[model samples]
Target: MGEHAAVAAVDDPVTVDRIAANLRELGVEAGDTLLVHTSLSELGWVAGGPQAVVDALQRVVTADGTLVMPTHSTQYSDPSVWSNPPVPDDWIPQIRESMPPFRPELTPSRGMGAVAECFRDYPETVRSRHPLYSFAAWGADAESIVADHSFENAMGEASPLARVYDRDGSVLLLGADHASNTSLHLAEYRADLDTGRVTETAPVLRDDERTMVEWTDIEHDSGDFPQVGAAFEKAHPEAVRQDDVGTATAKLVDQPALVDFGAEWMSDHR
Candidate 1:
């Protein structure tokens, strides 16, 4: 092999390895349970995109340590259920392509349930039963929520999540408020918004599984109801359009985390 080829392969593996090691040093020991919300593109193109990231992470936090992320498929929500309007059908196919596969064993809750299928393995640990205010919402007024979504009463009886959130061992924030949360079952935490009394939706589901989940967050940290700096996509100028995630990846080592999942996560999220 040419000296250059040898150097490239050697260097690349080293980089991926270093990335993994760095995460370990970030207090991610074998027993540490981690719940991460990441933008893969933010990390630049590592050796293998999301797969590489997961592989590296798994290396540090082994069998005992659990890794979680949001695999939210908010777009998957049935159009009939949307409060504002439907995302154009033509755009959906494109949107799906951009979405990574929800590999729960590996990625856990990345994208906040943008990839719901990944968490199918651990349904009990990752779901909320409230017809509204149900998706991983904690410390909520259960009686009020249960009464509104009568079906919820049935689901909650079987729900292992309601009590978990009450204990504050849960991580209710998907990192995105109302509009972006794929964890909509928890929207019931807020009263008027919980009933569809605030915002109405009539979306249908495929079988009993929800093709779409409805959400109305009049009270959350998202601020200004439906306006955020990142929501409205700007028209990209011609030439080359680079997304920010790749840049984000390289920058992660230096940035302090917006959220950290310590031992308390289990106690809070459970």
Candidate 2:
């Protein structure tokens, strides 16, 4: 949505304090480890935009809590897998060779939105090492949540998703649906499905030098995520808390329950 339209849609400016209050009402508590997925535009006109949203999250969660968000840089992956405006076949090798290595501190996340991009650069925020599916985190356990992000199985056991699961974290979907719920990928890893592996290459910094590394990992698909989420919500309605944060619909989910249910659901159906 455009700026003028967004401004016209809201009766009052959505301030940081307002967003924080909305988040608190949505079950976000102090010291809770939360993984957030948000749409800045969906929240309508705001007094401070993405930064205000981030600030509100921090205010609710506090420094004792942990905050996480996907900072994926799919553009750093193999050009062969590129379909959204795919490059020429001859240019693949050239792009790979010339592409800068993924630097957690420098490489900007692609398609992760303004809020995430801002969160990544926030003070004390640390990002994982996965070139394609890195996650940025802040507050307590920030380093541990993003630590040891394996090159293979970027969203599986060794990934930050698992760390969040270990911490009994919750997921906050601000104007995003189950399709954007990345925790389901952890279920895909555990579910009894033949998610075949694909060999992918990415440029990484090795001893402060650029080097191309290859790994094989399960090919993730989100086509069934929305359906799985709907079923889960139906089966466990009480676990999914729905409310309004700003002008956008928000949902606070129990991560472990959803992942457990998702694993069983995908195993039986898919």
Candidate 3:
């Protein structure tokens, strides 16, 4: 369903307390590390909006558990290949030269939604320095998870996704689908499949000054992620849990199991 349809699925008003209660019912425990992809609108109208959602998540997870969300600033991508709202041919060089460096404190996540943006802005949250695919995390292991995001391996074993996997994290699909499931990218990297690499450029801080840096990383493809998620649900039915949080249907899955299964699936399919 489209986002509008998901929003229309709920009619009742949702509050922080209601969301907290729903989270508990949805198998979100106090000490579980959760990487969440959310759509605030799908939960119906929230009392305090995204902040209330963040508050409710934090309340449920408490101070012990970690909360993470993608804070990718995709606009920092190479302008040469821009297609969506593509810029003029002559403007590419200007954009390449003038684009501001990615500052974890300053760059805003492009399409990550209001809740993720608010989470990234939280005082205690620590964000990775990856120019394009950075993630923001909060709570106990936030710093460790986001400490060193390798430029050469954006979502590979060196990235936060691997750390979350190693910690036995959970993937929370809050009114979102497999298309937004970033942990799968780690599986793509692990698979024996031969996806090509692409050279991308972004403005990053080097020696406390902004500099345009070019790097080559694996090209990502999510065309089969939906199928992969379906196969995972079928293969490990016990590990995949589903329930309603507010009006949105939420799914919680074991991150390790999903990635393991995804790696095998990608090897065959990709």
Candidate 4:
């Protein structure tokens, strides 16, 4: 019912296959560390459920490679802290049941949910810890990986993603564009590096998982969202000028159709 992907009112196997074929055409191959930020609802009824979607992607990037998706378990001790209003409040209990924190000891699973399962146990890679920055510095070129943007003046505390974009290395934007991309928070990270203001915090995770890490963020709300979005766009236009982007996932690349909301805004506002 929100901004996630879906299969029209009538299920479409044809669309799923198209998504599969599109992935193949995107140059997905073995051993490419990749990061994927997505909405499972986007690929309505993918064959074999979420695992099937993971399987198709895994096949493309096989052989000593890594595929990363954000298994973000920003579990709040208080439920009011949760975002993604699209998800039903009733679904939270089940969401808690279906997905847990990245269990380093457990083998990563695919299909358990769909997108999140693909990144099971892969949080350390996607959710990196930088004393000064927030957002996963995921990508082959660490120089390009950035994480520092945050909403200023908004919570008594901060979320893990509040610090990082959630990739192991290289970065990609699937459901949203680079404008929505959080990894580039790195652009602001450089500023924090010099200010000596970046600090660490511990955030509670779903299923009682806890992470101790350093992070920096601005605390503004919707007022900040607009500004943060602006800063990100100006900082990473190169990411938008391309069809494919590698992210911090286990060396994976998600080939998603790119949309430019920033451009639309300029046309309407400017």
Candidate 5:
């Protein structure tokens, strides 16, 4: 069956209360800082859709807890490297010149899904300033977490993922898998596994002028994230918890534990 057909087969509308309850069952607490990676469709047609999912997360985390999601604008990067439906070589300069500067309020997420897009639209959310690797956060500690995302190390020790790791936060995989677990990128940095570096350029609004800037950042590779995650689960089963949120499977894992295990695993395996 096709993806939409499978979803239609379930057709059960999930509500805010139900989502919140399921989150609680997945080990989310009242004052937890959660980095969520979600697939809205897997939640079985939420009543209010992405907004309802965001509300449910907020309800569970409450005002004291912080919520975070990757709002990366990958399209903001250099057009010269575009591969999927790549523009003609002659158009690279034109595209770069015309590319709009990254705006926290207006720049839309490319592939982060409906839930993250909705969360980014949240009025109280604070987004990182990085043009390509921005992250949106809300609630307590949000500002401190996303305030300084280093352009040179987008997912390294200088990024929001580092703060989440240092704060002993949790990762909530709501119908998403290890591939979407961005925290793993931190382990790649920690492992110092020679993932290489890539020089990327983007347009940014600086002093009311759109300026094109270039920076060399560590090339983050998630090719083995699934394998690493499987190894992590095997090594630290106690730190990982699983449950259901709506019809979607949910995983709650200790960020620090995963990173620690992942660093070690990558060092030995990668």
Candidate 6:
């Protein structure tokens, strides 16, 4: 939505304090490890825009709590799988060979929205090493959550998703649905679904030079995530707390519970 339309959509500008208050009311607390997915535009007009949202989260979660966001750089992946405005096949080889290495301090998150992109620049925020499925984190548990991200099991047990699961984290969806809830991908790995592995390639920094690396990762799908999320929410209402923050609808979920329920749901339904 455009600025004017966004401003007109809400009665008051969404400020950091207001966002933080709403978050607290939605059950966010200090020292909680939280995974957040947000849509800035969905929050209507804001006084400080994306930064305000980030600040509000930080304010509520505090330094003792960890804040995490998916900072995936999908452009670094094999160009052969590009479907949103797919490139010509002739350009694939050139793209792969010339693609820049995944630099944790520099590479921007593709399609992860403005809030996450802004959060990436925050002081002391560290990102994982997974080329395509990296996650950015800040606060007390940042390093642990982002440590040792396995390239082959990007969203599986070796990934930050598992670390968050270990920490008993919460998932906050701000103007985003369960479809954008990446935690479910972790469940996919735990589920009975024998989703085969797919060969993937990414440019990485090795000995101060960019080189292409290949690995096999489990084939994960989100086609059924919405169904699984709906079923889980319906069956376990106490596990999810839904409310509104600014003009956008928000959901605070128990990450481990959601994953467990999602794994069971997928196993029985898929």
Residue 176 shift from truth in candidate 3, angstroms: 0.3
Which pairs of residues collide in model 6?
none
TM-score of 3: 0.96
Give candidate 2's TM-score. 0.99
For model 6, residues 16-69, the per-residue Cα lDDT tens digits are: 999999999999999999999999999999999999999999999999999999
Tens-digit lDDT track of model 5 for 1-270: 235754684656689999999998889998899999999878886778899999999999987999999999999987888898798999988888888999777899889999999999997999998898899999999999998788898888888999998889999999999998999999988894867789988888889999878889877789999998988888889999999888888999999999988898889887
Regions more than 4 Å wrong, model 5: 1-11
Model 1 over residues 1-270: C-alpha lDDT tens digits? 233443443424434476566664444556444434444433433555445655665566564444444333343333444456667777655554453332213333323432123332332233332322223211123222222332222222233323323322222121223244221223223222322223322232335443433444332233322332112112111211222222232111100011111112212332
Give the candidate order by descending TM-score.
2, 6, 5, 3, 4, 1
Off by over 4 Å in 3: 1-11
Could you give me the TM-score of model 1 versus the true structure?
0.41
What is the TM-score of candidate 6? Answer: 0.98
Candidate 2 ranges beyond 4 A from true positions: none
Q: How well does candidate 2 score on lDDT at residue 64?
A: 98
* Candidate number with the higher lDDT (4 or 6): 6
Top-lDDT candidate index? 2
**What lDDT score is found at residue 198 in candidate 2?**
92
Q: What are the lDDT scores of the predictions, listed in order?
A: 0.33, 0.94, 0.91, 0.38, 0.89, 0.93
Task: Give the Å shift of residue 110 in candidate 4.
Answer: 17
Against the true structure, candidate 5 reaches a TM-score of 0.96
For each candidate, give its TM-score against the true structure. 0.41, 0.99, 0.96, 0.46, 0.96, 0.98
Cα lDDT tens digits for candidate 4, 1-270: 222333442344523355555565555555565555554554444555555555555566553555544432233222334454456678756654544334333434322234555544333334332322222322342223222223231121242332223322334444444443433333333222222232224332435664433344443112232454444346554443223211111212222211123223323332
